[model samples]
Target: MNSHYSVAVIGGGQAGLSMSRLLRQRGVDHVVFERDRVGHEWRTRRWDSFCLVTPNWQCNLPGYAYQGDDPDGFMVGADVVDFLEKYAASFDPPLLEGVEVTRLRRTRAGVFALDTSAGRTTADQVVIATGPYHAPAVPRIAERLPAELVQVHSSQYRNSGQLPPGAVLVVGTGQSGCQIAEDLHLDGRQVHLAVGSAPRAARRYRGRDTLAWLDEMGHYARGIDEFGDADEVRLRANHYMTGRDGGRDIDLRAFARDGMRLYGHLRAISATRLDFAGDLAQSLDNADAVAEGIKDAIDRYIDSAGIVAPAEARYVPVWRPDSSPSVLDLAASGISAVVWATGFHRDHRWIEVPIFDGRGYPTHERGVTGCPGLYFLGLPWQWTWGSGRFAGVAQDAAYLSSRILDARRQRFTDEVSWLAGTPTETYPQVEWWAAA
Candidate 1:
């Protein structure tokens, strides 16, 4: 194995693969390290019925965009794995699988020292593309629940059959939670969903796919600085919806109409009971408002473009009782399972650097970190709203690769100057293009 490389990409997913492809194009020497097979999360973390929320057209890598017949259709988890595998195999990147990057730190001489499961290696540049979601983020209150009750995260859940027999309480209203609740409910399990402030979204709006419209409007490409509260926008909950069910709406209101019991946020868990916040109705209203705002934006776009389009019908609001208790006795309700879908936090514990902000997210100008020779990719709002998605990482990767190329050029210039007895100060210093 090569102990040294110009760049070391710390992942094997779309982000890392795309970065590697761009680096290779620039004639940059690099190696990709993965703890498991390529696209490990798609192979393991996702549920059995998992599918990409974005359509096939949005799944773009560096050299390979989705060329399948179903451009509008969503790819299932296994199909995604196949796509990634083919992408990696096609280029045959210098990928070292089953090699976990246990630790990464910058040496005194400014090179990255990576301690991996395979062996130690050094790189002049390092790109952390491990993605946003790392560990399951169940609340600490869950530990107070009874041991008999099966507690599974969305990552651990496969099918309804895997869960013990009884009613299930899914403690989230994000995309994953909504989809999982629908799956379990449709499978004949009594489902109770804990609604939160997750926004609702219409899968299609104004005679076009919502995602397509957003792309057309440059919504996805909006930089973080464009927002008033950048952190708030970055940390905003994903809208409640699903690409399954033929792109039908799957918000909290939809779930309630489907006979699924809805509750507020999971506040606490006692020995045999669960306490919820009394804000279900308010939460649903907030989600509906967001949905309306999105549709309004689409309508404005149609008008601004002078495109003739049919008016879309508005969704009817679902009603709930004004007075509902804020508590549930889990034992009395016969709830045997709790599926926590509270989302995930990026685990950068292995990194010993000061490039992180107060929230532990990497502080970067695009993918280039404040620390020279270190970078991050596939992070939420890393550059724009789409920074973390399949459609966006390629752009960020290309930008980062260009920066690396500039650095490589400078390195060569310095080496030649040193060998010729020329003063290093006489060498021309060229600045790389800054991300816009």
Candidate 2:
């Protein structure tokens, strides 16, 4: 083994592999550490019917693009895994599979020492591309639920086939939750979706891809640093409603068309029962209000941005359900399952770095971390829309690789003066972005 390389990538997924490929193109030596085989996470994702939300064309990884017949079409999970494996094989990304990184500590000499199950290794630079969706974020109220009621995180859910034959309660209004609800409804299961804030829906305006248009207009390219804090928050919040693909819109109308019931967020979960805040009429009204707000926001953004377009553009509401029902009351309606698609949380207890923020994400700029040579990629909204997604990781990897190369070049010039030393403090120093 090289013992030390210019860079050490701590993941083997699209992010890490892409970074490796970019580094290779730049003639930088690097090794990839993967807990299992390459693309293991994608291969093991909970949904059997899951397909890339971003089309195959967007799923490019470094030098190679998706060469299959369906460039614009979504690739199934297995196909995606296969593509990644092939990409790695073609590029010969230096990967150490089945090697779990147990500890990543910063040596007193400023280099990162990775302790893996196989052996220990050190590198001048480390890229933590372990990704954002580490663990599911189930609500605390779930523990109160009676064991008799089946509970499964969306990550563990494959399809309606795994669910019990009863009314299904989905506790989230995010993309995963909404999609799962739709799937269940299509499978002839009674689905009750517990929604929190309404998400921004992808509006197919005049048959154009909404996301493509946004990209062309440089929407995702602008980070929170470029836009003010308020705009960034609004953009982040709006993403919940808007589908990643601009063209294939997921609207309340679609959910309603599929006969899925939408309800207010679940307040409590008892044995085989759930409690919601608002009454049925009130819940419906709330959902409508949220949808209207999202629609208004989209219109405002388009108008302010001077996006001249026809008024006949289709607007998808964030939430749509004619009526709502209590979780307990749904039993009488024959609802029998609960799928929690409430998103994920990062678990960095094993990371052994003080670099994490309150949310457990490593504090880094681009890919540079507080500890010198320690980097991170594949983080949610790290840079832009494509930061953590499989399709977006290439851009992130390229940018990150450039930064690392620059840092590596400067390392010999001035240890303390270069890059102002390892950042002891986080950036955007505002209370919102700052670590709590």
Candidate 3:
């Protein structure tokens, strides 16, 4: 509600909250503006059974870490919400929930001006921590589907019971699609899945969870710069697996073996019919290949270190589609619902800055942008694999907080120099002189 702040954090998620904790510790003047309630995505977007794909131990904020008994277990959506609530309570961050910042641009004076739902305000610096997922990416082809058929983006989906009484067609093979398909299948509903090229990962390897192995192997800490082509790495899809049912590999082949219909990438949808690419076998094979590839890397790490661990066998496909079904009659199959888990795209149009790339992604190093006093956080691969994730956001916030303070100090030094050089009569009524 203040007319101005030294720093304005543009989200109240883990990223913004972590930055607030650090700035608080450093005695910096900052406020967090959240468009919705804190952790709204975790509280609402996910399904009833939705749990963290990562282990609880990985849920580390700036000062708060998971201290529950089940460090190895995954936290469900409610658990995640509770964790964030507790973290916020611990520090009691200066957060304004339900206050949306609709527009942000640098004023003529070089200060950041924000036109929020409440009113206009300005800040010396702004941390755009709204994250990358803003728009649900439903394909335009969905318009061709019948008006009667139930359709919902993955974000709107909650559980199988929410769907109509009939077969379900889930499009996409990413984490959301796969997990939703499994949710429907387990509830005795027939599920037709349109698989994509998203890779899969092993749930566990050598008697240890693959994530645990990766954490120890320093995979999460590997910076994006470590890759030869960081741009390509940024565009890469995340390896899909599940932490549902206490964490397990989502073997699509096994799902097919159990009568869950599988198809290739969804190409088109005609009246009463749906078309798919003839690459079901390739998709499945590629997913398994990636999963195995991760296992191979873990094996090499264990061998070189001589780490004693249980020996585990590699995965083999349990079932294969006899024929690539390229088309399906929607009416005859009794498919009454469609879930579009096609993922999300960034929506930074509200930000009137010119720092975005062709894809509308902010051009930044770590979190600091080329634009002075502008920064970004909670972006996938922002610095490392865990940069956007709870496991790594603390480090990113710490680094960004230091940068913020450095910028603040530089501004103060410049102002002092200007004041000293100027005549004593000028700036006599300086409103912010005492704060300095």
Candidate 4:
């Protein structure tokens, strides 16, 4: 790669690659820097049975959509990597894999400087496309557990075979937590799951997948700006369901009825003993409510459109805790392994920019920040419900590409005007629009 370029994309994932493809199409000099080999995250972080929760038809990259015969089916872990690989090959994006960018800061020359393992490089603009799963957010209580008991963050977990021969206690009920718990449960390894307040969705309803109906309602296309409570809504835990075994709802109540022990939110830990809040019933009830709520919306949509759809009965809770377990002795209960499926937080500390809020989340309108020459991409709800997802990232990336090109043009015009004895202009503070 050259010492500098018109733009630098600091990730090689879907977002970064999409950005690269757009820039190349526009004839902009750019490069994509990936910290690891291709498919590193998919290969490492995901369990063996991991698959896309959404259907394969939703994998819409820039100019490269899914052409597989099984568009209605879910692409497993390996299939996902292959699709990305083929997309990259289709365009031959300028990418440098296995090159980690250690830090990024504004240079004295008003450009961006990226310090990487290879060396330092400068660029006119930088797009941080590293999606937000940087650091795992395991609870501190994990440290108090017995040293002999195997503990792995949800990212590190592979399969029940890798774990010791005993029961597995999975904490948290987000998508990852629920899916991992199901993974272990399917292996017939007596599983214990700690339920949280994450909502749930139906796998299929009214003779079609729930996602299909939602997509028909234009839910995926709605922008985050339409919401009155975007902040809380953006951070809300994703509804838990699985695309495994030809797509099915992970009914924790069904799991409980099938002999898997379910508990409420984990409260605290003491040595080998663990305490749980008596919210198991409430948690299950809340999840069911959300799932039903989605159906309610879909039912309304069908009625409004005057469509003839088969009616389905609302879900009834299959099992309930006769009495919520308030406490459990890990050693006595035979839980030899614990999987902390708690969610993760973004770690942008390496980016020495002041674009973050007090909580360290990047503040931006869409992907364009107030800070000139700096932008963020692939963030949760960055623009819409699917902003960070495959269905919507291409749109987000295209928006960023326009802003990047606009900024480049404005910078050029300003520099020429300044050298010609006109007063220099500070970069315009842009919000959802390019510099004027």
Each model's C-alpha lDDT?
0.85, 0.70, 0.91, 0.89
Q: Write the per-residue lDDT of candidate 3 for residues 123-185, one digit (tens) a residue.
A: 989999988888899989999999999999999999989999999999998899999999999
Candidate that scores best on TM-score:
3
State residue 181's C-alpha deviation in candidate 3, in Å.
0.2
Shift of residue 248 alpha carbon in model 4, Å: 0.8
* Tens digit per residue, CA lDDT, model 1, 219-276: 9888888889977887888776677755667766656777788888888877887788
The lDDT, on a scale of 0 to 1, for candidate 3 is: 0.91
Which stretches in model 4 have alpha-carbon errors above 4 Å? 422-436
Worst 10 residues of 1 by lDDT: 427-436
- Candidate order (TM-score): 3, 4, 1, 2
Highest lDDT against the true fold, candidate? 3
**How many clashing pairs in candidate 1?**
0
Error of 3 at 66 (Å): 0.3
Residue 205, model 2: Cα distance from true site in angstroms: 1.9
Where is the poorest 10-residue window by lDDT in model 2?
427-436
Per-residue lDDT over 47-113 for candidate 4, one digit per residue giving the tens place of the 0 to 100 score: 9999999998999999999999988899999998998899899999989998999999986667888
Taking the tens digit of each residue's C-alpha lDDT, what string does model 2 give over 303-403?
88887766653343445444565556645666666788888777777777798766555777765788766778887677776777765678888888888
Q: Cα RMSD to native, each candidate?
A: 4.2, 7.7, 1.6, 3.9
Descending-lDDT candidate ranking:
3, 4, 1, 2
